[model samples]
Target: MILIAKIVSIDCNLKCDYCFYHRWNQNSNRLMSCGTLETLIKEGCDYSPICAQFIWHGGEPLLAGLKFFEKIIEFQNKYRKNGQNIVNKIQTNGTLINEEWAKFFHSNQFGVGISLDGPKNLHNTFRKYPDSDGSFDATWQGIQILRQNGIIPGIIAVINSANVIFPQEMFEFFIDSELKNLVFNPAMIKDDISGLPTGIVAKPTDYGNFINRIFDLWLKKDDPKIEIRQIKSVVHALIGGKYRSCRFKSECQKYPTIECNGDIFSCDGDEQNKNIRFGNIRQGLNHIFSSEIYKEYRRKIQRLRISCLDCQWYKICRGGCTRDYCSRSQELPKNYFCEGMKEVYQHISDSLKYYKILPL
Candidate 1:
């Protein structure tokens, strides 16, 4: 299981228009206390059956400072069980990365994911600073620093309408920048605190075409150095590989996100809703596991929609993210991107046949 620690709360330096935290109005000055981190690590390690991955997320995890991670590494070593290993990963905006941060990450063998949309124009369209200044240059510089430190950072680009139209360009940019592992998150439209639709949500078909174009570009590469998680995940599962992506998982709520103050949420996307709060570290993992909310989430996952069950790509998609289904209706329904998912899957299967990457 994965435990996402929102250590720095909703304290980000850049204001990305499509950020879920921003739309939810999750502004906070809270930083995770050492005691909370200690308790969380101990509880997680003790309860995990095999291994636990702690994904440090935030407004921006680096905002918590280097000393915080130093102590976290120490605590991880101190509490880890003999057979159960603990892995740390951080998903950062890449603006705060420097030589010191890169060195520490490289030395610890930490998995790093950097957020970059594409080239300057596409990226800066949404990702901006407090003064409405573009952050593409700063972010790219951070990526370079990590590379110089001998760490290959994974790229996560959020797909909006503006960038979706330029999938080839995006793929080329990542290749040129030496980014290997990539993940594209389709921008979701959700009601903000004021009940207005927030961010530039990509049309379902546009997202499908965008990924298809990227797959075309990905297939044409002689080296095929880049690995897009969105495509690779489905391909891996279709070929009977054991994978753990929430998008293709039977239960999306298996991974719990713990807030800075120890408030546990079912999923990171569901953090804005107080109703999804199960139990905190103070209450113990057992208490959270036994809660009705958690049970209901599991139950919902098991009870797949008839439409989803009947769909050909059900196994690979698994009805997509549960949060996407329940965002507005307050109920777990069929995935909103059902058609788009089908299109992408069909495209992938066809490409695999043409390239002979998998058995037809």
Candidate 2:
């Protein structure tokens, strides 16, 4: 079981236009308390069967300061059970990463991922500081520092209007920067009250085309080391393996996201949705996971719609993310990105068949 900990809450330095977190009131600068952190690590370590994976998510996790992470390492080592592997990963904007930070990540063996949309112009279009200054230069410099420290950080670029139009360029940007590990998240911002996707979200067709371009570029490459998370997941699914992404899982399960105040939500995508909350760490992981509320929530999310069940790619795409559904109904949900998902999956499947990875 992986824990997605929003350690610093929604207190980010950069104001990206399409960020879903922007819908919530982020005036409060709440940091996860020491007591909460200790309990989380202890309980999380106890609960995880083999590996206790902690994904340090943000509103800029680095905003919590380096000392907070040092304490996290201490707590993990203290509470780690015999033969239980502890893994830590952080996703950051990369503006704050200096030589010291890079060295620390490398020394600790932390899996680092940076949020960069693309090259300077495309990245700067939507990702900017409060003063409206573009963040590409600082972020790029941070990437350089990490590389100098012998850490090739993963690039997590958001697919929006700015970068989506230039898929080949975006792919080249990463290759040029020597950032082989990549994850492209489509810009999908949902309306708070209505639960309908709105505002600067990439159109289904646009996203599908963008992904196709990247896939073509990827296939032409001589390097097998270049790993794109979405593409890898698709390829894995085509090879008769389960979709590695949470969004495309055959049955959606609880990969809980812990808020700064210790409240545990069902998924990172639906953190703001109050209905999926599985109580706090103070209640203990056993109590939270075993509670009737959590079970009911899980059941509700796992129910596949008739359309999804009838689809040929049910095993590959499942129903996609429930949160990305155009309608909020739990009984009969339809993903906003269904067309795009199908297009990409089909593209990958055909490619695999051509390469003789799949039987004709």
Candidate 3:
């Protein structure tokens, strides 16, 4: 099980416009205490029979300071059971990465993912520091630093209004930057459980067009080393491989996310809902996993499974992420991006057939 620990809660250095956690009242000083961290590590080690991946997530995880991570490594060594593997990964804004941080990640074998939402103009449109200055320069510098340390950090670019319209440019930017490991997440607006859109939402067709353009470019590449996570997941699904991405899976994986205060939720999507809180790190995973609330959450997903059983792209789309459901009712809770997703999936399937990768 992957444990997504929000080590610093929602306290980020940059104020990104579409951040889901941006609405939270974050106390910058609030960080995961050593005591809380130790309990989490011990419980996590004991629970996972095989590999335990600890994903250090945050408003900005580095805000917890470098020393905080040193403690994490120390505790992992202390509590890990014999023959049990432990892995660490950090998702950061990349504005704070320096030589010291990059070297630390490289030394400890931590998977680093930096958020870069395209080139300066598009990226700076949303990702800005407290002083209202753009963060592209700092983030780009961080990527360079990581590369210099022989660490190729993965890039996470969010597809929003600013960047979704320029798919080819966005694809070329990543290719030109020599940062090929990419994950492009379409920006989604907040929707109530009853399936009502409450905020500005990106056009689903625009996102589909964006991915199609990128896919065409990628297909034409002499040596397509560019790895777009969403496209890769779709290709894997078409080839009869499991789509491991949480966004497209039929059933949501139970990856618990721990808040800075040690409060645990089944996943990041349930973070804001107080009713869905499983328990706290101090309460142990057994208590959290066994909680009635979590059970009910799992039960709710079954409806999606039933809803998508008849879908032509059921295997590839898997009803989309439950979190992306426009409605959470017992009735069909169609995916918010269903139309666009269908178009994209069909395009990919047709392309595969044309290439003779799949039987025509």
Could you tell me every candidate's TM-score relative to the true structure? 0.92, 0.94, 0.93
lDDT of 2 by residue, 285-349 (tens): 99988999888877776663457888888888778776666667565557778898889988888
Q: Find the candidate with the highest lDDT and give its number.
A: 2
Candidate 2: count of backbone clashes, pairs at least 3 residues apart or interchain: 0
- What overall lDDT goes with each candidate model? 0.82, 0.84, 0.82
Candidate 1 stretches with Cα past 4 Å from truth are 23-28, 193-199, 271-274, 302-306, 326-332, 355-360
Candidate 3, superposed: residue stretches over 4 Å from native: 191-200, 222-224, 270-275, 327-333
Off by over 4 Å in 2: 25-27, 192-195, 250-252, 271-275, 304-306, 328-332
Which tens-of-lDDT digit does each residue in 261-354 have in candidate 1? 9988877764233367787889999888988988987775567555577788888887786655533445445566677878999988887777
Ranking by lDDT: 2, 3, 1
Clashing pairs in 2: none
Tens-digit lDDT track of model 3 for 1-360: 789998988889887777766667655577988999999899889889588889999889999999999999999999888798999999999989998999999999999999999999999988888678999999999999999999998999988878888988888899988889889887665643544444445577877888888888888874567788888899998988755687777545377789888998767764223346777889888877887877877877766567678889987887776655565555565677778888899999999999999888
